[model samples]
Target: MIIPAIDLIKGEVVRLHQGKFNLKRKYLYEPLFYIQKCLKEGAKKIHIVDLDGAKNPNKKQINLLKEISKYQIPSIQIGGGIRSQKDIDLIFDLIPNAQIILGSSIIKDFKNVQKWFNLYNPHSIILALDIKFNKNYEKIIFINGWQNKSNMIFEDIIEKFLNIGLKYVLCTDISRDGTFLGPNINLYTEIVKKYPEIFFQASGGISTLQDILNLKNSGVKNIIIGRAFLEKKFTIKEANLCWQKE
Candidate 1:
């Protein structure tokens, strides 16, 4: 599946190159308008990130979500600032039917994640792994929209989460996220190979259809495209049409 991203900051649709918080660009279309364009273009799922909340817990992006949720677009999956049960509760209160994604929160407190997993249906939860491939080639999951580094290794973290009964994970290579360069195919391949049972949604650095093809070849079942899809490097219609070709 292809999930188009809607990054929010003070109610604007922004894109960050390489997942860097400082490198953001505002889109011409409004948040809801952009989401509608993507949905009409053939996207079955939408990905939304609360940028302000990701950077500062004091901020929220509920307005953008409320606007998008007004439409009966396909499934909407959201992440960012989901640290506490209150935050989760607030999200459910606003967009109750939307899928909830945990970013740095789940990594910081696995117990809370476990509790949510036990309490809610697995389909409603997604663990977002914002990762960085270090100079030594060690893969580690980054947090706070790739600003902070986590001690957890990618594979080990996946193993731990999978063992805890969490089935869905959105893995984004911080080094390539929002770059529109290309995805970390080898890293995705390795992870998918190790945990084939986990429902992995690959994100970051998808620039071309070949990148999508390579992801499919690597065993990835779903992917998130932010910069590329919005920039017209490719269109959602093209992406959906190409899925069958793969």
Candidate 2:
């Protein structure tokens, strides 16, 4: 599954190098451009992150959600600034057909995560496992867009979501996110091997057609691309071939 990214800031798809707030690069494509491209590329879903809301909690998320709702994409997994139940409600209200991704909020308050899931159920929820490698190079979950550490074990969080009837997970290697270097396959491969029960969506630094092939052969359920697609490192047509091979 090839899931294209639409990282939004003030209502446009922008790529952030290494997830750095100051290093944002806006794409020439309008939000609609990415939607049409991903759909034509045989993408069943699209990953849209609200960057502005993630950095500044007070920032509004309606415009981004509105734009997504207008698109005819099958499923849209959206995240960033999704802290309160009200925030989740607002998103669902705008895009009732969308699947919401809860990131930092899950780490900070699992109960709140549960509350939303309890109300909305599996179809509406997905946990985004945003990870940053520590000094030891061991992957550690980060919240608030890599600003704080959750110090949680990888499967521990995955298991929690799984037990609560949430079956989808969108994991990212923040260290590799938007770098266009390469994905952290060793890390993803291990997760897919260990947890065959949950659906895994791999994100971060998937720069080439080969990288997509590697992920598919390794059993990754889905792949999310950012910098590589923005930088023209690979074309959507090429990415569709990788997914077709799977």
Candidate 3:
């Protein structure tokens, strides 16, 4: 699935560098704009990250998210500012068809992740394994909007989450996100091979249609498309067309 991304800051569409809010470039579009535009371009799903909520767990742009969800453009997955079960409940109550993403909170409070999944069902939640390589090339998970780093190996984290009934993981390589270089094909391919039963949502570094095709051909079923769409490097329309002909 080629899912277009719509990142919001102060309720406006923007793109951050490697998921960093301090260094961000605001785009000239509303949250609704991407919903309608990406859908027009044949997007089957959309990825929305609340940069504001990621930065401060207490804050959120839920109203904006609610508005976007009401459009029924496609199945949506939302992340950031999702700390408790109540938050998840609110999202589901307001946007019934959306998936609630758990990122930093899972690192800080994994018990809640299990509890929420048991309560709301694991099928509606998506986990993020946002990671970076250490000096010795050891993969470490980063959370809290990519500001804090954990000493845990990336694979172990994914294993633990999958054991807890996590099926869809947004495995993002922070080093390549928003860079438009290309996705970490080797990383995703390896992870998929290791966890064939789980669905790994390939994120970060998708620059061209070939990148999408490469990932798809390599067994990646879900790919997140971000800055490329905002930058006009390729249209969602083109992406869908490629998918059809290929």
Best candidate according to TM-score = 3
What's the lDDT of the predicted structure labeled candidate 1?
0.82
Error of 3 at 46 (Å): 1.1
Error of 3 at 150 (Å): 1.8
Best by lDDT: 3
After superposing candidate 2 on the true structure, give the runs of residues whose Cα lies further than 4 Å from its correct spot: 135-137
Output candidate 3 Cα RMSD.
1.3
Which 10 consecutive positions of candidate 1 have the poorest summed lDDT?
60-69
lDDT of each: 0.82, 0.81, 0.84
How do these models rank on lDDT, best leading?
Answer: 3, 1, 2
The model with the greater lDDT, 1 or 3, is 3
Q: Write the per-residue lDDT of candidate 2 for residues 1-246, one digit (tens) a residue.
A: 788888888887898877787887888878878788878867787888888778767895676678668777788888888888888888888777778888888888888788777788686787888887777866688888667778786667877777678778888888788887788888888988888887889998888898998888778888988778767787777898867876
Model 1's C-alpha root-mean-square deviation from the true structure amounts to 1.4
- Residue 137 lDDT (model 3): 73
lDDT of 1 by residue, 1-246 (tens): 878888988888898877776788888878878888998898888889898888777777766666766788667888888888887777777767778988887678888788888787777898888777778887888888678888887777776767667788888887787777789899889988888898889988899999999998988889888888888988998987777688
